[model samples]
Target: MSGLFSSKRLRWFAAAIVILNGVFPALWILFTSLKTENELTQKPITYWPHEPTIGNFISAFQDQPLLTFLTNSLIVAGLSTLLSLFISALAAYAIARLRLRFRGLILTAIIGVSMFPLVTLMVPLFEIMRSLGLLNSYWALVLPYTVLNLPICTLMMVSFFQDIPRDIENAAMLDGCTRISALWRIVLPLAAPGVATAAILAFVNSWDEFLLALSMNSAVAYRTLPVGIQLYQGEFAFPWPIISAALVVAIVPIVVLIVIFQEKVVSGLTSGGLKG
Candidate 1:
């Protein structure tokens, strides 16, 4: 092991292997998306397309209302994350700072609830949404997404809020700031790392949720990206190129977000790793 690490050439070779393992699937998808259907199913597969084209990308947008799907996904995910963060912030503050009775039990219950199998909750959730007349609206998705993610988000926020020095909030109170104002001005700013972590988790979970999205909104006009992309199938055949292109398009927002907030995300996760 020591000799392997000491050799620069061997280390570089190992790094290249790991990188290829991670990147090759994406490269394959991109290559397949550019291929004509004939090339996709050719007897002897070609590594590169004999004829490369952007027609699949164009058709992905034209054949489906990809833009509408994107909009629905953004609205549901963004709203769910924001509301989850707001609610979790207050909940975390109460449990962490106010030192509520049975705080540990409350947090444990929250974690247990979040661990419930999504499949088990589907039937009842569908019936309730139907009864409430929310079946075909954004509320059907947002409400569940926010609820499903709340416990975990609250847990992470608790961990983060506990990490803050109580003296800081105490000092703010001494300076004539009320508890609400101090939370708004002092502790929340310090807990930005945790908030970012919770926001990312909630947003991504909501964005990628498929089963609930599929069951809640059967209307094509109300579909989110994950379920909408699956619509590339037909009665007689499936179109792989257009499907792949749609998937690539679907993931663009998440990839861009992760890239932009990489630092905040890292800091948030690490800061929320400790307990009080």
Candidate 2:
């Protein structure tokens, strides 16, 4: 009875801690975002805004093309996610299912490529994009983003596919289903969780990516939200309230995405890492 009571108390404590850690930072951001420029700069720091106003957000939007930045970010991130998932799924299925002599070699190469730091490819990638006249276009960011994410995404899909039984594929084959049909109809449906996981990860990476976006997009009209936000700060001065508001805006989409796909993300991660 004592042990059972102790376990219950421990579980409750853990739950409380998790909730507190998650809620506190978000609440703090929300609070800070509501403060005015003066209140934000005052000595002794105000915990709550005295006169909470939407002016900071208004200024942030007005000062820069926030909507344009957001639209560019969405387009780049969305397209990267879709393209990465499509290619990774096909490559992963091939690696996982095909009884080829070089299957192990191919998988090893794919995993090995992921271990290399992305910075190492910057020079070569830039030259290629320059030669192709894609340096200032969306394709410059989209193509690199897709390639950068492919290895990990493929590995994830491979693990998920491995968890599926081979008998299912064989059954489909006996029913006159081709390899492509079996992949699309049988494997894809069962691996929905893994695909969603890959898409979310690719989306987040592309959305938050700064180095490539900053280097490649030279025009103000092509700048992404991350790059545009940096322009708000100068060497000697910065607007804390407006910057905070921009940060809030940048995080909103990511928060909404996680909330909506919480279940699938958790399940995909656990199954991919542990089960397979």
Candidate 3:
């Protein structure tokens, strides 16, 4: 009885600590976002704003083409996620089910590509984008983001597919289903969780991608949210409140996505980690 009580107490304490850790940073950002520039810069730093206002958010958007930046970000991230998921799902199905020559070798190579530092490819990628007339266009960001995310997404889906029984595929085949039909009808439904996980990851990566977006997009209209937010800072100084507000705005969609699809995300991650 005592041991059980102690364990419960420890669990409660751990939960409280985890909640605190997660909530504090968001609270800090929120608190800072509400502060005026004067309050933010005041000596000895105010923990809470004396008079909270949405002026920072207004100013942040007013100072730049934030709506256009957000629209571009949404298009790039959304398209990148969809493309990555589509390509990776098909490739993962092939690698997981088919017995091609050097299948293992190919899978290893795909995984190995993900391990290479992205920075190493930046210059080459930039040159390629430039030569192809893709620079400053949506393709410049979307294509590279999709390709960069594909390896890991495919690997993740492959592992998830492997967890499913081969008998299921065989059954579908016996029912006169083609390989593609079986994949679309049978494997995809079972692998929905994994696909959702891959989509979330791809979306987040494409949305947050800074280096490539920065290098490839020069037009203010084409810039994504991250790059747009950089404009909040003048050459001489930064706008803390406006920057904080912009950051808060940027995080909202990601938070909503995670909240809405959190169950699938958790299930996919956990199931992918376990071998059947």
Candidate 4:
């Protein structure tokens, strides 16, 4: 009994440490955003703001076209997530349900492709976008984001698809449902947790992507939030408070997404673990 109690306490301590590690930075940013610039520069640092104000949040927008950046990010992330899920679903279903030649090799190739560092792809992607006349445009970001998200999304869904019984799909086929139709009406619904998980992951990746967005969409009007946020820092000086406020703003959508889809994400992860 004492040993079990000690083990439980240790697990709780580790979980608390992990949670604090992730939560502390965001909490610090929020606190900093609420502080005045004068307080930020004071001799003695303060953990909590002595004089909190909404000025930084207001200034974050006024200092840059933050709204436009927010809009661009939303459009890019949304489109990319939809495309990633659509394509990944088709590919995953084919890999999981269809007995195609070299399916295992194909999956391995996908995993290999996804493992390549984003920096290495930058030059080639930029040149491709330029040649296609896609640079400084939403498609420039969306297309690459979709491609970057595909491998993981497909692999995740494949695990979920494999977990589902073939009898369910075979019965649907007896009911005059084609494979594609069954995938739409049956397999997909059954794998809703995986779908939700993949969608959230894809959206978050696209939302947070910096290198491709910065390189491909250099135009101010086309810039995403991560790239646009840099405009807050001048060569001469950094506006820490206003930048924190913008960072806080940038964080809200992702936080909301995770909170909303958190259950599905956990379910998908747990199912994947068991499937493995």
Top TM-score hit: 4
Indicate the TM-score of model 4: 0.97
Better of 1 and 3 by TM-score: 3
Question: Candidate 4 lDDT, tens digit per residue, 66-88?
Answer: 99999999999999999999999
Please, what is the TM-score per model?
A: 0.90, 0.90, 0.91, 0.97
Q: Could you report the Cα RMSD, in angstroms, for every candidate shown?
A: 2.9, 2.5, 2.3, 1.1
Model 2 compared with the native: what TM-score? Answer: 0.90
Q: For candidate 3, which ten residues in a row score worst on lDDT? A: 267-276
Candidate 2's error at 221, in angstroms? Answer: 1.6
lDDT of prediction 2: 0.90
Q: Model 3, range 16-53, lDDT digits (tens) per residue?
A: 99999999988899899999888888899779889999
Task: Name the runs in model 4 displaced over 4 angstroms.
Answer: none
User: Candidate 1 on 79-132: residue-level lDDT in tens?
Assistant: 999889888888988998885789788988997898899999999999989999
Report the error of model 3 at residue 141, Å: 0.6
lDDT of 4: 0.95
- lDDT of model 1, residue 8: 78
Could you tell me how far off, in angstroms, the CA of residue 229 lies in candidate 3 after the best superposition? 0.4
User: Least lDDT summed over 10 consecutive residues: which range in candidate 4?
Assistant: 267-276
